[model samples]
Target: MIVTRDLTKRYGRTTAVREVGLAVREGDRYGLLGPNGSGKTTLIRLLLGLVFATGGDIEVLGLPVPRRVRDVLPSVGALVEGPGMYPHLPGRTNLELFDAAGPGGGRRDRRRRIGEALERVGLAGIDRRPVRAYSLGMRQRLGLAAALLRRPRLLILDEPTNGLDPRGIREIRDLLTELHGEGTTVLLSSHLLTEIEAFCDRVGVMDGGRLVLQDDLATLRAPTGRVVLRTPDADRALALLDGRVEGRDGDRLTVRHRAPDDLNAELVTAGVRVRELAAERRSLEQVVLDATTTTSADRADRAGGDPA
Candidate 1:
């Protein structure tokens, strides 16, 4: 669990996060979405106590950050920007060194824990090649493996799937889902809308270094009062529905109906051959676009602003 109030972080004249009130509950697959330099990474760092905030409060796992960050860090796993590793060392050796440097975990079980983590990240059969020889996707997996090294109760991941192919992404998603099912809370920050849409239960949107929206994903994606009716008898269905029909394209009709089941029943009774029927809903993309302003890059291009 994580909570922040009026959490503002500034680098000189540049504000990376402003007046942000973030709440991530236990057992939540929370997705933090934003454009490039939108303060997501900064916020993550603040929560992890990796960066000090200019103003406001931060709480992670029920402890005040920075002051008590050390107490809760053993229970927290994070991958920010990317995993730092000695390129000349093999993946296994890098993980060994990382585990040794971190607190908690018994030294006797380090090898077994490392092996399990590697297996979970699809690197079970990885050879003794140095990390520098691994592909981008492989490196990403190694970073994730590092995060999962301790099976922390909370995971704070930024751009977790960066450089991964579709299959790799899905594998990671499944792995995270499995971890969530085992009571691990996930705070995922990514630019990939589809990944967030598919994996997250709640979402938070940030813009201009501000927390613009935070709510349940289902509530944000609530269905519109319209049903998409696909039928071979589009003209007939349109005639049957009359003024309720809002738009039509070929065999598809967008009808202003509150109940899709009732609409389908009426269409069937009226001899309309319905091919498919579903309620229209707002997509994560639409919700994010509506909540956010221009990207930080765009803002800088116009005014030479500071990066988040």
Candidate 2:
């Protein structure tokens, strides 16, 4: 439901996004992962037509951006930074005013939709309370409820789990899963890879204004035959393997290979009894860190600056 090609955005002399390409299909629970200044928000803004791209093409919900923003925005629900709230107003009243401001449902239908949205975000009982009294998690849920009021086909959220407790985080994750099950295409931006790993079907890693990696979480986490072994003689193993082994944690060794079974067999044949044989797989956080760090280092090289 969203597509971009060579999308670039600039501000004066600085480019915030560069040649970023993305495609999110129907019912995709996609995550955009990046660090503090890696241009994730810039790309989202370009997609939303909140900011014009300096170059390239973008189409959201099958309509060209900026040109079609007015026509398509009503069908797209977004909580980009955070949901703005009238702190003094009751939660339900806040939603009511929002619906009244937009081309939303009539009063009767709006009330029904508001109730449903509140219930979906786990804010059903606190409808009559002022938003100022709500907790950080409650406010986040309220934001989500506001977005879902129209039953939008596309949902975009930035850091929806920020400041949420563990239970609240779980709540939002389950809610997103439920929405995706109902065929809502969601594009979520978050710095927390664990959360993204748990909830997102596909992920795109952005860094230095570029999408360095994009793949399904399942495919991304497919097992590789690398192992961490605690052995009786680490030095002896390294001698046998001729420096092919990495790192020595006292008597432990980390070995990378296409076939860990073969390595284990060879180690056993060489009279090095393995104490532990555990697979070494990169976590979601590690994958993201590696991608963004590489991109940042490359940028530093091009700019003739010290690496961050």
Candidate 3:
């Protein structure tokens, strides 16, 4: 439901987003992940028309941004940066003002919609409390309530759980999952790898202002080519396997190969008794860390020197 071609954004001389191309289909629980300053937020802003793209094109819900933004925005809910609320206003008042500003039909319908949104976010019981007195988690829920006032088909959330505690995070996660079940296409940007892995089917990883990789989580999971075998003849097995032997400890050796049959066959042929064999895959955290690794050159630039 969203597409971008050669999308680039710049702040003065520094590039924020660079020649990035991406597409999110209907019913996609897409996660955009990257380190700080990797253009995740810039890309989100460009999509929402919050900031003009320095270069390239972006379409949301099949309409050009900053052009059909009027038609597109009402159908899209976004919680970028954080919820901006008037401290003096009550929680319900904040949503009422925001809903009234939007394309609502009548006062009664708007109130009903606001109530539903507050209820959805678990703030229905405390709707009249002033926002100034609300906790960070409460404010976040209030922000979510405001975003839902329009009943958006697409939700673009940038760290929706920024200030939330563990319980709050789970609440927000469950809420997002519920929204997804109800057919809302979610495009979220987060730093939490576990959070992304929990709900996102696909992820687009960004580094150095570039869209490095975008694929399904299953496709991106690290290969499980490493197998450990405990054998009586570790030296013989190591030599027999050659470069496939990654590490050895006592009678046990770690072999990096796709198939267990090949290792077993070779060891058995060489008259080595295989006492045990086990397989292991790299963790999801490792896969993401490897993908978004900052090169030494990047570090040098950040250190006020030319790329090393």
Which candidate has the highest TM-score of all?
1
Give the per-residue lDDT of model 1 (tens digit) for 261-307: 99989999998998999999999999998777445456667887763
* TM-scores, all models, native as reference: 0.94, 0.84, 0.82
Per-residue accuracy of model 3 over 1-308 as CA lDDT, tens digit each: 89999999988999999999988989999999988888998999999898999889999999999788988988999888888899989988888888777653357788888889889888879856678998988888888888888778999998888878888789888999999999999998999988998889989988878888888887777557888899888888877888888888899888987788876887788899899986766656876677766443566678988653
Which one is best on lDDT? 1
In candidate 3 the C-alpha lDDT for residue 31 amounts to 92
Query: RMSD of model 3, in Å?
Result: 4.2
lDDT of each: 0.93, 0.86, 0.85
Determine which window of 10 residues in candidate 3 has minimal summed lDDT.
291-300
Residue 110, model 1: lDDT of: 94
Q: Which ten residues in a row have the lowest lDDT in candidate 2?
A: 218-227
- Candidate 2 lDDT tens digits, 201-265: 89999887899999887777766656788888887888888756766688887777667788889
Q: Is candidate 2 or candidate 3 better by lDDT?
A: 2
Q: What TM-score does candidate 3 get on C-alpha atoms? A: 0.82
- By lDDT, the candidates rank as 1, 2, 3
